[model samples]
Target: MLYYATTGALPIPSGKPQYQQPSYYTSGDSTYSVSPPEDLDASVSSASGVASYGNSYSVTTSYAGSSQGEYDSTGSASGVDLNEYMQERFAATFDPLPLDKCTAKQAQTSGHLNAKHRELLELQAKAQARLAKTRARFAQGLEDAREVRNDLEWTQKKVASLKAKASKKHSKEYTKARERYPSPDMY
Candidate 1:
């Protein structure tokens, strides 16, 4: 609701009809009336329409006391009428429940347990924690396994070449390596 002011500022006072009423301001005639809504506290100020909520919001229009953009809201029912309707509807629709007919067995089972149950509950909690920690570690992953497998294959090939060269009488260092490191797979 953006209002465009054609002549000047909107809401020219009703008492000062010269600013709002076309007849009073330009045409030189005099006739005006204020019409309020069923749910509004409305009035007129020098031919300007004045409508407002209790004190929260307000709207005024100045176009011969009947602007197309003006709006009024004023409808509220009292509290007593609403309360009576709700009570009557509830009595007709609702029924009460009976809790007075229980047997001896029902009364005895509602009692609390002794100390042994509490100890068992604590033991169950510890078992669950241990299981959770094991699952978390296993979930860390398998990349290290793949790396170790690759290293083992490379070391095996290196050892086989060293053993082949060690058969040569002049290769004394290969013999020393075989004694010192054993084999990568053994470790």
Candidate 2:
């Protein structure tokens, strides 16, 4: 039977193995009795006294059921200790690792490794940033060089066109002058 401490209600036994109901439950320094239902024809009588523990009291209850005449003093109907059964069921299965396996030196080494990893990541980021800047500068310089080359080609073409025009314009004048001032070899 489960006892509710807050509501002080007696819960009907459900699927649990046959065990004698707890007479009383202790909380802090007070003891509260859990009386059986009236329909069960049971009478509960409790005696309370100060326990060995400081300021705490204990209760001893006598249950007289009509069918059983008197409750089992062992608090178990089948002679099995519930506490021992629970302890066996909930016992730890494995041993904990020794403290020596996790030393302060190992923790310090782990911290140092983590710091170095962070440093490496930061350095890689800086290097990538520098590489990106270098690539951008290289691309800009190539564009500038292309523009300069186009300008130089245009200037050269213009100069060649001007030279051709000047030579064609001066050709007739040069012929007339040469005819007027004949060479001594011709005389």
Candidate 3:
């Protein structure tokens, strides 16, 4: 539905200044030239629209009679050029509007999520610390159990040695007493 045309050279009609379309829209460095058609009326609206950077310029041609071209040019929306009208409207309507900020609800929701994430991280750290402490305590308990078992073994060995010595001494005393005292029948 949109058509874009580009040509190398276009002839300008005799006895009138030619109107040209700009090449670049952003920089405004492109030149605007016009070649009025031969059959075109004298009151025809020029293609050169109002353009402004620092200063404003209007290139619309004035017509004498109330011709069709003159009537069309003098229409209600025709007083100011399209580009000028758009620029003015944009400046008036768009320039004053401020940028929107995050709403209170959104801020609160995000804060809650952040707090929850931090809480989860803290809990994980605590769990790991507790697990390490439990492991350390378990190892300590195992060491204590091993120490108690070794003490019990040492006590058992000492008691066995004392029992063997007491048995030997009591046997010797019994033998000496029997040799020293005779039986009643023998006496």
Candidate 4:
């Protein structure tokens, strides 16, 4: 009699075989069936008796079909050869130059320095051009200021000469004007 602890029920005695034949195990989308050899029962019993005395036991299994089919089928489902595709991708991205670590580092550093040198040269040229342009503008401004100062000085001198002529009392033109329009106070 077999007792089920969880169900708390005892199975009734029946005249049937103790072991059932091997059956299929179903998983998602796949079914697997395993059949034991004719003498597996005897071998397992003997193996179990040996294992009871603290001995190691191992089991080996071999499939009938070629294992390569699994990999080939998976690759074909994606429309490409997996091995070839991986090789091509690896080759495309792999860098094969400068095998030595020190040489690779030196090459990378030199390349960076060369790029920086070119950028510095370009910046220096631009700065020099800007300095030249600013100097030219400054010189032109100074020249214009000098011209304006000279013109202002010339105008001041001309105004002073005209004032000197108009203020003179004994000039011939002034005496003639005085006589032609005799003063009314003198009468």
- The best candidate by TM-score is 3
* Ranked by TM-score, top first: 3, 2, 4, 1
Off by over 4 Å in 1: 1-121, 137-149, 165-187
- List model 4 lDDT by residue over 1-187, tens digit each: 0001121222322443233332554446676653322232323322123421112112222244634133332313234566678889998997767457778899999999999999999999999999999999999999999999999999989977874686494477756876898756679
Per-residue alpha-carbon lDDT of model 1 for 86-117, expressed as tens digits? 77898778654333334444554443343556
TM-scores of the candidates are 0.24, 0.39, 0.41, 0.36
Cα lDDT listed for each candidate: 0.47, 0.57, 0.54, 0.54
Worst 10 residues of 1 by lDDT: 71-80
Clashing pairs in 3: 18-34, 19-33, 19-34, 19-35, 20-33, 20-34
Poorly placed runs, candidate 3 (over 4 Å): 1-9, 13-106, 171-187
Per residue, candidate 2 scores C-alpha lDDT tens digits across 82-177 of 667666776665333554556766898999999999999999999999999999999999999999999999998998797577658898875676
Candidate 4: misplaced stretches above 4 Å? Answer: 1-99, 169-187
Candidate 4, residue 11: how far the Cα is off, in Å = 99
Model 3, C-alpha of 176: deviation from truth (Å): 20
Best by lDDT: 2
- Candidate 4 local Cα displacement, residue 152, angstroms: 1.2
Cα distance off (Å), candidate 2, residue 35: 44
